[model samples]
Target chain A: MTKDDLLIIDALQYVNWNRELFEQAREGGVDAIHVTIAYWENFAEVEANIAQWDRHFEECGDLVMPVRQAEDIDAARAAGKTGIILGFQNCSPVEDDLHNVERLHAMGVRIMQLSYNNQSLLATGCYEDDDAGITRFGREAIKEMNRVGMLIDMSHSAEKSTLQAIEYSQRPIAITHANPSSFHEALRNKSDTVLRALAESGGMLGVSLYPFHLRGGSDCKREDFCQMVYDAANLMGVERVGIGSDLCQNWGYETLEWMRSGKWTFRPDYGEGSAANADWPRQPDWFRDSRDFMNIAEGLRETGFSDEEVRKVMGLNWLEFFRDAFAPASSVGA
Target chain B: MTKDDLLIIDALQYVNWNRELFEQAREGGVDAIHVTIAYWENFAEVEANIAQWDRHFEECGDLVMPVRQAEDIDAARAAGKTGIILGFQNCSPVEDDLHNVERLHAMGVRIMQLSYNNQSLLATGCYEDDDAGITRFGREAIKEMNRVGMLIDMSHSAEKSTLQAIEYSQRPIAITHANPSSFHEALRNKSDTVLRALAESGGMLGVSLYPFHLRGGSDCKREDFCQMVYDAANLMGVERVGIGSDLCQNWGYETLEWMRSGKWTFRPDYGEGSAANADWPRQPDWFRDSRDFMNIAEGLRETGFSDEEVRKVMGLNWLEFFRDAFAPASSVGA
Candidate 1:
């Protein structure tokens, strides 16, 4: 396929969106984006978020289209618009009901994390003192999500919870934005065990390009990042690796704080951040925004990935995953 | 202890309250009883049920007292009143939050079934086509329940789910109302595997006197039941078996229909009932009401059980269990 034919999908991006950001994504040839629209919002709050996105689609329809199904991605590519697949970075939107999983899926929410950076109802977050795996509701929620076709995202879930989710979920789950802890020993990073099990379960790992997760922080060399991807692909097949970028662009420090704390604690929790550096970490120079995605593709080539493999890792892999992820379960007697 | 002084705690009883029922329990020398306060009710609905119980307690202050802990049974015994321990027959009261476990525990809900007669968020009921065991939320609910001191009742859960609950719970669970399937082959009855596991895990089996679960239906003889209890205690230790007379009193067939088909289906689901037999089954002649509890004690003696064994089966075993069931988990390094 030609460069134009290459389906470039970012598995995750939580940007404070505007026409300019949409234009940047369009310029970057981002066919679709799994955009995080909810973090710690309850059901009504998420509905309000969706209403705001409804306005975005109304005003910026030329730049972005809502992707409710896998075929919608193809439609967005054909129409030259970035397909926005709305997602939640935590289980709060579902509140305490598996019925909400179906409700949110109907509202065009295509993906959701079992936990963020704390102990959620469904699963333990990466920052919890104990990883209790998936809770009773989490299992039911996973089943409901699987039936209704919302991807289970384990990006910020604890290791035990994430691993259990990968095992328990009928459809393959997604680590929408995380790097391997073997490459960089960050608490947010996944282990080799999780990575391999993720691949074995036909799951995808959206390698984060956000500097906090990268080995060298904001100065992470493009070559080194690409090399890490190459090694990760070697551990987990190339068909499972893709860029999530974790692009948290144009959001204030307060927004980051909300993402971390979200009424869970009385005091501030820096999450993977420390008191010494308690703001959103700076992005790597190479992948500061959606427009710079091709830098990874070029670096992948430099790191000796084949053109077919580069195409697969960039977006084709996620496209394949989405085809399964968004289809309603084959109900036995429905 | 003398026969008059023996602690008599029935593990479960769901009687539509009246002064006569309390008087009958008092006549039977019953000290404490685990009374199901909710079944298939949501959080608010359960609160309403609790309010009704509060009114019952206010009106019948001379005959009944609420049991909030193991010690409350003794308090009721001293006051010559029947201790009413509040419990739920399903996890519906908790809705979808583990936080609710603590909240409900605070409200004096000491026991909850993970499921009833259909698929619950926590577990599959005995009547489901498939038993997928405990869900993700079930796991967390177990941990939270363990910490908050709620006795998990698996009386109506499916086989796999019951076994899993026995294995997964840190504290011992109770099959608060059911017989051994080896004795009757009823859908609600526990298997040899589940019974052995329950006993091994320090769990209790409140041998059900509900006719629907008995071997010979309403004609079930006192001797046959006492023999079954003896056999059951032989299988699952003597201390693990007690009476949980699932008495449905002071209600019409409409209440039975509600119990069997609570908004779960558009059509009537008879549950353990067949098409020809859709009303509530009659209790055995020996166990028609709380006043008949001594009939069981006498039958157990006829079945060659010692006075101490009868006392243990009647209440002391549950007393030993309650000592552990209602104490909030010791917080380490808090």
Candidate 2:
């Protein structure tokens, strides 16, 4: 497929929202983008975030449209606008009640990770000292999410918990943003064991282009990054891999602090980087912001991938995943 | 040691709290008993349960004393009273907050299962269609529980979750009440994999006397029960096995319903037994009430166990477990 005909879905991104960013995504020919709405906010705070997104949808109507279902991507594409899918990086918004899961699903929150950098109520985060896997509440929550057609994301979750979720969830889950530990030993990156399990279970791994998760950090070459994707595709089938450029743009140091040290702890936790450098890490020159997504596709083509394989990795895989994942449990196979 | 000299600790029992039950436990020469305080009640509701327990401790002071540490067992023995160790059969008492773990531990609650017969926030119950293992909240809760000296229990959790708990917990956990599935294939009975894992992790498996978990329900003979223990001892060393009894006395059919269907489910869930038999399952003639505990010791002695082994199966093993499991994390070894 040509770039215009191809479905281009960025499975995850948490960039500071503005008309500029939406225009950039539209300029990049991004058909659908899953946007992070909550990091560590509680129920009410998350509701406020949703309310804010509602305004953004209105203000940027010409540039972006809200995506509540897989078909919405096509709707956005037909309108010549980028589709925005809201997601949460942690389970905090659900609080202590499993009922909140269905409530959030109703409000257009399609994807929610079990945990962020630290442990949450659902599954262990990658930053925990020990990963106890999923909790009793987590099992119930997973069933509820699956039943309600909400996608379970485990990008920041620990290995055992990620594996258990892949096994336990009836529908396939997603690692919406993270690279493989084999390529880069970042704490947030996944292990080969988890990636293999995720692939075998028909789950998707959105290979992250976040600077901190890239080998050689912000200086990583486009060829090297594409080679990583090629290696991941060889390990996990090409259909199970996609792009989730976790590009955090136009956010200040305060946002970085908030992301790492949510109210869970009073002490500053400079996750993925040391405290010596306080600002957000530099973005790689090869992949910066939504506009650089096509660079990855071009790089993949150069790295021995066929045009079809490049298309799948660039966005088609995530579009297929969204088609299957964004439906009610009863309607998924049907 | 003689049966009289052995510290006869029943690792688990949930009886209708009355002076008669306390007297029966005392009559059985039980030194310490881990009593179920909460099943599915939330934090505030569990506090009400604890308040009720406070009254029980006040009224039954001569017959029972609250046990917060291993030293309390000896105190109860000296005073000729059974030490009551408050425990929860589910993690509901902690709700969604990790701080509640320390709060509950301070209130003298020691043993808390990650789930009941259904999924909880912490781990998957055996009744769940799929076991998601432990959740992110469960990981933080386990560490907090470990720090505060509360014991993790997994009697009603699924095999994967139970084994995960065994692997993840810093301190040894307990299967406070459940028999081996090898003895009887009840849904609640554990698999050999879990039993071996429990034993290898220096944990305790309190063999259940609940008829549903027995080989032939209420019709199971004393010799058969003893033989199952002997077989279990061969699989998991004798040091890891002890009596839990799971004795339920003077409870009506409604109580069974409450146990099976906690507040989490609106519909009645007839756990372990059918809805046709709503009342508590009939206990074997050899083991009916707290007073029937010694009968298990006699049965073990008859089934090729030496007197020392019988004492270990009856109570000594639990005493040793409590000795190591009830101290603050820092003081336990150092």
Candidate 3:
């Protein structure tokens, strides 16, 4: 197949989405992107966000379609339009109610993070001093998410919480966007132990391209990035590795501040980025936006990945993962 | 001391609060009542409820005063005004945020139930099929409640959840409006195991006078009610027992429906009352409104309780519990 013929998916992105961004995603030939519809927003607040997304779909129907099931991604590919798969970077959308899991899923949310960068009712975030692991509500939430066909994304969760979530969840979970700490020592990255456990539990890890998660931050070379992914694939099986750009496009510094602190604190919480660099970190030159997915595939090919392996890592893996992950347990029957 | 000299506290009441009800409380000589300010409300919704109460405070300043600290109960007793100590019948007001515990506390909410009449993130309510005990969110909520001096009330929660809450909580919890299941075997009532655990843990049990929870429903005799309290006091020390008089006054059938089923189901939830008697049950003739505290006190005296023992069960015990319960752990250091 030609480079243009392969499916492309980014498992995570929280962009200031508009028709322009939709057009850029189309230019990237992206089949689907799991866009965050929630962070610290509660159920009502998230519903308002969904209303805005509804408006986006209404206004930009020509360029993008909403992804309800995995097949919609294929339809988006067929239609030459990007599928917007709704997700949450935190469980705040459901708040304390497990019933909201099914509700939000009904509202087109297919992925959810148990915690953002703090201690939540479900699990501990990476920033917490103590990782209490998956909480009692967290256990119930996992079951509800499993039952309702929502993917559990532990991208920003603490290690113990993430591990416990993988163990407790009946269905395979996803670390939708984060790299291996072995490749880079950021607290947001997973350990080798987590990576191995995740793969063994039939989970997937979306290697992040966010600057802070990279070995050389904003200056990381594409060869180095491809090599890191290759090492992770060797460690976590090629089928379990894919791209989740963790891209935050068309957003100002205030959005970054909100992500870092939410309403959890009055003071600044310059998360992963330092106080001196208390803003959205710059993407490296090679992969600045949605248009740069080809560079990643080209770099992977140059790094000695066969075309089949390149397709799997680029989008096919996530497509397959979503195909299995986004069906209600009763409908799928295991 | 005369009966009027004794401090009178009703542990739980949810009146469609108005100047009339406040005047009735004055007539009943109720020094303080832990008023239900929330059932299934979310943070914003509960804030609206609080705002309404603020208006009440402004308009009916002659009839009532908001109780912030426990000593405010005494101030109300001294000033001849009923103190409104706000509480919740469910944890919905706090939703998923632990920080809201302190925020709600600042807004004058002092007691909160982990669940109302269905399974909540914190605990299983009385009406659920299975009792999962305290949830992960429940544990964290317990800690935050302890820290913030919010009384954890397990009134409508299932047995196992109640027992687990008492076990996990560092400070004492209250069953603010429940009777012993031994006295009358309703699902809403506490088991002997729960009673023993509660008393052993320095907790309090507010013997509910709600007709459905009472032995003979609306026909329940005042003597029988006092006898039940006397028996409870004998079984568990008198010091741990007090009146909760679950007086839900001045609301329509819709309010009862809201209490039984708050967006949890598309269908109706009759709660403790059956579909045949699905409407709010009538209060026993002897205890129709807040103006019936003397009847309870007199019945307790006639049920072989001495004046001191009557005072203890009527409100003195609750006064002591509130005195200890409403101060933050940092201030109380207990």
Candidate 4:
């Protein structure tokens, strides 16, 4: 791939890891991937998740390299390797103390979502009926994360908490995987106010292809996905927009059943005790039996975004945010 | 006193509570008092402070009645009882979680300081050299305070944190004890930007009688204090001007020494390390031992302000702000 090629960055992806997915990512021209290591796991559980990644690295070490800093992305590109930055979907791993954030930052867990889908001690989740914003503990968590230069992800936070978090986190935060509320007034879609605030706070909004939160809602086509990305870019300039595909490929009925249970689900609304619910098949039929991810790049090309805009939408924007947020803050005061 | 007679609320006071101070408050004809119950205390320690007050209520029950709601101020006035609303000079008691906020509010803690004199997880204290605005934690704390109807006080917060907090807080917070920086440029004084932001947030600026932060420092007369208040009124209308004397009349050298210590002092530069070391005996030599708080009323009259303006400067303004900030928020969404 050329330096000026559309270097897509899958800002978020929860897919089951396999050679097929890695091959698809390469075919799709995704330069880097911010992959999840923790969702509902606590300290030991999240540590175990990281340990599991040790095996993934051993098995697929040629396909991916752990990214602790922004420079690592460029290094990965030079080595022709897919840079994988470890991320978390919740702050439950750190529990409540401020010091744990430092420990996690050292572990290469670079990005963290403050809440999942309901109320935690730190903040309200996206699925919460009341969007009561960030809690005092959550505020403390943000400070700790900011201090250690961790990217704050707010994709699954309550509306009020998200806004407050955007303002509070001095460094840029990310949506990681969310669609525009203007496209579909679903709970998962962010409204224009949120998008505008995120941009103002020097943050980026990663448009997602979650299908469920899409305007078409499960019947979404690749063209529909491109349009959603374009819409976000149109509102916030292309420089501030990117993709967080949120693809959950390779999961079967039994796996889906486990994913739906509270024990497996980070949020309350998505699961129905077991992942085996028939409604779980609401994923669009077109995506089924698709063995490659190259279609995503072609879809963007069809959407008429320039090569540079496409690069940003892929992963460059996320990298820029990571570079700024991950830098250490000195004893600097105003 | 007539209902229409101006009633100035000593919005903040940390006097050594005794029969003398109570009699002084009554003699001063103070309508209501926002009394301190916590400073550098953990959860249990703060509870003890409140418990002490509970006993004080029993011992001198006829002198004062606790004011949980704004309307209670009126009840205290009508019943010929001194209104005592619980307040915190520092927000160290709520610990980390914001759920504790609701508990404190339930216990009648209506006002809280964002920071004392140095940095906490939330905001920087006024005495801190680095004024690095409000922390992510601080921002979240304010939102929770807004939700639970707690008034945010920034009398001892750093400058940038005060400015950012004023902008971020949904409700108008109170600078319960401070002077104008335009007059003295002291650490304890606030700048015009701080005042303007606070005013824009629909908040009140409680100009205090702390002489060290006044124009002439310890040399300021009662007229200088009135002029400073008038200048603030000129900047942020009469409706937003009120009084918050950072008064402490109960203790002597030992109190000052304690305040200067790290346990009580949030900022290292706040005091010279003891009441003995502090530029005592507070107020210039001319005003020393002047027992009459009514001099403030006379000073306001000297400013040639109308009775309405004087009424606001006394306590009406703070009362109005309390009503607005503590009210339930109805609107929700992007």
| lDDT score of residue B158 within candidate 2 | 86
lDDT of 1 by residue, B1-334 (tens): 3448577888888888888888988998899989988777878889999999899899999999999889899899999999999999998787655678888998889999998877666777787655657765677789888888889999999998899898999999999999999889889998899999999999999988889888899999999999999999899889988888887788888888877766444356778888899988888988888887888898998998999999999999999888888887773210
Can you write out model 1's per-residue Cα lDDT over A1-334, one digit (the tens) per residue?
3448578999999999999999999999999999988887878889999999999999999999999888899999999999999999988788655578888999999999988876665777787555656765566788888888889999998898889999998889999899999778998999999999999999999999888899989899999999999999999999999889889989899998888766434356777788899998888888889888888888998899999999999999999889888888973221
DockQ of each: 0.06, 0.08, 0.08, 0.02
TM (chain A) per model:
0.97, 0.98, 0.98, 0.88
Interface RMSD of 3: 7.8
Q: Which residue segments of model 3 deviate by more than 4 Å?
A: A14-29, A43-82, A89-91, A94-334, B1-5, B119-144, B158-170, B328-330
Candidate 4: stretches off by over 4 Å: A1-334, B1-4, B264-276, B279-281, B284-291, B328-334
Question: What's model 1's lDDT at A115?
Answer: 82
TM-score of chain B of each: 0.97, 0.97, 0.98, 0.90
With a 3 Å backbone cut-off (N, CA, C), the pairs that clash in candidate 1 are A96-B96, A135-B136, A135-B137, A136-B136, A136-B137, A136-B138, A137-B137, A138-B137, A139-B136
Fnat, model 4, is: 0.00
Tens-place lDDT per residue, model 2, B1-334, is 4447567888888888899888988888999999998876777888898899899989989999999999899899999999999999988777655678888999889999998866555777788656667765566677888888999999989888898888889988999889999889988998999999999999999988899899889999999999999998989999999988898878787888778765434456678777677668888988878777778888888889998888888878888888879898889752
- Least accurate stretch of 10 residues (summed lDDT) in model 4 chain B? B264-273
DockQ of candidate 1?
0.06
Error of 3 at A234 (Å): 16
